[model samples]
Target: MLYDYPEYYETAFSFRNIEEESRFLTKCINRFSKIDVKNVFEIACGNAPHAGLLQEMGYSYHGLDINRNMLDYAAYLWKDLPNKVNLHEASMVDFKYPIKQDFAYVMLGSLYLNDFDEIVSHFNSMSNLLNSGGLYFLDWCIQFGDPLAHNNNNRFVIEKDGIEVESEFNIKLLDQEQQMYEEVWTIKINDRGRRKQFNMVERNKAILPDQFLRFIKERDDFEFIGWWKDWNLDNPIEDENNVTRPIALIRKR
Candidate 1:
């Protein structure tokens, strides 16, 4: 599972709304955290669109990811902000920081610990990296209608600097019992007369909301600070109609 194709990943996903998301994060920090937040940490940060916003908000940003290619891409993208941005190649479950951070977050449901023990270990590691009043935030995707209904094909086209990139996604639910799904993406890049094609497969497990909440509660290091449906802080988690993803906020106890 090499994540070297950062250009394809960034083209396939939309991170253009980072400013709005950063504003919401600031609001959450103000509402939930009791201490002044100066430093921030991110786990499994791929290409780090949010870290740019954190830097603009005057926070020293440190990001860790298991993929070396992604870290390299992040370093390239954030090269101008060297003083404020730092990226490390590390795993989510076994990474350490010299100084304690005031806030930590993982977005886009990237907390991919499969088992309970792995979840506990990741949470404990995060708790150890945070100060007493620090906050840890993450989001989980919940199936509202049917878990099997997500099997479909989608296409996207992105144009930049007179070059067009076309991406086709073939998605399927591989195993319901294991909460596993697979996506095969076929990408075509057309630059003038030159054309290139690449295919990649991505597999991931869908972690349920209740299971994650239970895991956090079982660990005494963090206090559950409630969850919101989607990006709206005013909306509660019970409102499933508007929430495709549930965001959980926890404070280090």
Candidate 2:
């Protein structure tokens, strides 16, 4: 099940800098495309913090996710926004929108589909939804070696208002042949001394930059722009081992 614990999902990654992230995305759209980016689409927008900020910036935001729980949470998060914000419960591989978008993005490792066919299908669907010369951006973490062996486990404790959240993350390589891994997140929440705990296990594939570039080149609907090591557009991806999350920017042909 995807995003089984929406509460834990909200708590685990609660500290992300939404303003900076949205600004980065906006900068990318401004620099790469000639169209005025008023409508934006996001694939697997969990909680949609970025979309909420983007909507506040006067863009119409549309977010799609297969998890209804996540979409409901995203709706609640964006309830106070003034601009148009729409949340849809749909899979990225086969979703069809009524209108074409000027820009689209898939943040985090949400672009990791089940297999090569699913990846291709997602790209095709996304390309079909974008106008000519539009932009599509995606980012994901690349695992070079065993994450557990490298002591990559994380523990986060966040306290806000009257609630306290403690989250522990454990990652393990599940299959070597398929280049797959699983991340188990255990979250403990204390709200006014009332304690609750839950666990969410996420399975993802480690797709290298070369593999993604190859896929983009194979498709005629998109043209490869460039890639960044992390979030900084100035820093190109030189060594995959040095960077945890790499971002790819492409344009629809």
Candidate 3:
């Protein structure tokens, strides 16, 4: 899989503006966090592209990922930094940390839990690892618009520094009763003259807007803050019309 190759994986997602994302995270912390933020953690942090940036911004960085190669690559990239990024080898659904994080975030719709039980467990795990006033920033984890709209512009090619990556994504309804979907991602890569391909298929629970709010309401440890579109707090999502890059925030109670 592309995730096995950290270099190729980072190259494939090189289109993201790391500086802009870091700035957004800073703004989120400054604007929403109810605690004195000291450190942060990234869920499913592959290669932890933001470790260096977070360290430079004066926040201790920690990450959790199941891939050892990704963690090692992240460490090697920031090995010279004054504050080292500590990475834990674990799954996103359940894990514990010796040091609790003041702020937590997951990017690019990577919350892979496939059922209500898993979702509850994930939040329970998060509650255990965060302080009372900590915030969790979730990006694109909810299916706001039509969940079946998977046919348009699902393919893209990204090239950086002699490496080319072509990626295609497809989503299929798995179970309508529980709102589950199966996602298949195919990646074809070319490094100079060599060619490689990887495919990843996974089942994820489709968390809808109403379902998310209801779930948050049922939980005793968390309270829904709000959701926005395009990373702008002023663009609050009311009815899911302009659901471009939807992000939600919830605070630990």
Candidate 4:
């Protein structure tokens, strides 16, 4: 099963700043109007913390995650706002519901996957999930444009409640044509010399700003708004600060 390790799932909690993320999304949302974005949907909404903010803002928001355990935890944490906030165990690729929404969000590069065709299908699906004048905001990773770089592998180890868990990540380039990378996630738990292993592999396309713009531009269902290259909402596309992770917005046209 995917995301079976409780420890790794817990580790992911620290990798993001939920409050800052919420603020960033809110800034984007404020671009349109103050009218209640009455209905909101978030795909790959791990732990669903962002939905909490949306709920506080008086929006009816739904959260969806591919991991069952993550969704279960979200349900427990957000039990008080059950009506306003609902978390589902589903992937962004195929999740569907009856009601369309005023806004939809997919954060933290979670949309990256093995297939470009599947990714396009998902973008289209998400566009369909929004209302005519609705918005879909996405924050994703972009290729480091530096001329000097190489395949990188990294590891993080932490101790919580006396349990030592180690997580290893390997990012490998898949040649030049596709500009894709295969990510290998491995987590190991060790207690008094006894170790257990859990692993997951996913292939994702590494995006660049130009390519990203072209892809979104070619889609007929949506109109490309712009991108935030380094968190500057105004003129974010050209503001490169050594690295570029873009937050792009689109309106269902």
lDDT of 1 by residue, 49-129 (tens): 788778888888989898988988898898887475778788786667787899998877677665456666777789889
What is the per-residue lDDT of model 2 for residues 10-30, given as tens digits with 9 covering 90 to 100?
655768787988999988998
Candidate 1: which pairs clash? Answer: none
Q: What would the per-residue lDDT of candidate 4 be over residues 58-135, giving only the tens digit for each residue?
A: 678787788888787777777887464676776677657678888888776777555677777787778777888788
lDDT sort, best first: 3, 2, 1, 4
Evaluate all candidate structures by whole-model CA lDDT and list the values in order: 0.76, 0.78, 0.88, 0.70
TM-scores of all candidate predictions against the true structure? 0.85, 0.89, 0.97, 0.82
Model 2 misplaced regions, further than 4 Å? 1-8, 141-153
RMSD of each: 2.7, 2.3, 1.1, 3.3
The top-ranked prediction according to lDDT is 3
Q: Where does model 1 exceed 4 Å of error?
A: 141-147, 168-171, 191-193, 239-242
Q: Kindly report which residue pairs in candidate 3 clash with one another.
A: none
Model 4 residue pairs with clashes: none
What is the TM-score (0 to 1) of candidate 2?
0.89
| Model 3 agreement with the true structure over 5-112: per-residue lDDT tens digits | 999999888989898888888888899899988889999899998888888898999999888888888888889999778999998888888998999999988898
